[model samples]
Target: MFKIMIVEDDPKIREIVLENITKWGFDGLGVEDFSEVFNTFIKYEPHLILMDINLPSFDGFYWCNKIREVSKVPIIFVSSRNTNMDIIMAVNMGGDDFIQKPFSLEVLMAKMNAILRRTYSYTSVESNIIEHNGAALNLKDSTIIYNEHKLELTKNEFKIIYLLMKNNGGVVSRDKIMRSLWEDESFVDDNTLTVNINRLRKKLADIGLDNFIQTKKGQGYIIL
Candidate 1:
């Protein structure tokens, strides 16, 4: 099943979209921690993202720009603020489609399916094996390889590590990281991210990848 990320703030809307997505045979993930949108995005690496315009802390446009920097993933804007300016801004921010709220779920699914087919379904994955140094990530199977030692990762863990490796040698901002983790960046607790990162680091160390990840004080992390 294709994985999809939903970034709506309203519980009802989030559920509605997820239901439709699931009905279309796509696995859906709703952002639990809005405060860490980018982190969740990378951690989950959803095939497509559904975003709301008006969000706490930073809006959808802000998060969209962040995601665009790391991946060519498709983003569909879903918002109640359906002004011409908003729609135009959504496109300018790299959204593939603008979906105004109070719309039919069927139409939404259609748009989503079309985007997925054009962007990924018609194209094979990039060998699924994303490698660096002695470490490699099997995108096809979602696995990791390091020094001939295999490491099985949860979907969240794999996405986190993949984004870090993709942006190696550069400090990826915390906001950027959060977006990958959760759709609503306003709801994520700082401790939650800390715990996940700490756990990932420990796992890497277990595989002899000590210090493979470096932290920049007040910034984010990088794979140096």
Candidate 2:
């Protein structure tokens, strides 16, 4: 079942939203601690988020940007602030849609369903996670977990590891890796690629994954 996370601070609204979400046959996760919204998000890995603009610690826009840095999960801003600028800011911050407060639960459900359909119609939930040799890489958050130790990865590190792990046991040439990096709009030369590989290796080693990536002589790199 698709899970939706509610980040509203009002108890009444949260309760109502949760009820309607359950009624619509979707699992609902309500946030109790506003301070750890991002952490809660990582823990649950909800498919969609209902965020309020006037949050306690940080506003919805801040949290939205934070989530965007890791995952492209669909976010809908549900807030009382209906200013034009507020709506524009929501979109600028990567929110998929903006719904004004005091909205009909039915309309909310409709929007939720629409976003879910458009977002997941082409992809499975498991596609966001890739695992290799007991190490799981979260494509959503640019983080990898091995032996219960989680390490956040930089953009370069993530792309490099993702390619290697996806093509597990096969040599990926340095040229191919550089091309991938270039495709990501990160212009990295041969030396930069080497630097990124070395750093990634050290991070893997830190998580008890020593020598996880093997060098294939003059061909390229491989994860065996």
- What are the RMSDs of all candidates, in order? 15.6, 8.0
Least accurate stretch of 10 residues (summed lDDT) in model 2? Answer: 181-190
Clashing pairs in 2: 70-140
lDDT of 2 by residue, 1-224 (tens): 99999999999999999998998899999998998787677767899999999999789999998777667999999999999999999999999999998899889989999999999898887547666776778877899877557899998899899999899678999888898887753555568888889999999999899999888889999996
Among the numbered candidates, top lDDT falls to 2
- Clash number for candidate 1: 29
Compare the candidates by TM-score and give the number of the best one. Answer: 2
lDDT values, one for every candidate: 0.80, 0.88
TM-score of each model, in listed order? 0.59, 0.64
Badly placed stretches (over 4 Å) of model 2 are 127-137, 140-224
The count of residue-pair clashes in candidate 2 stands at: 1
Q: What is the lDDT of residue 147 in candidate 1?
A: 51
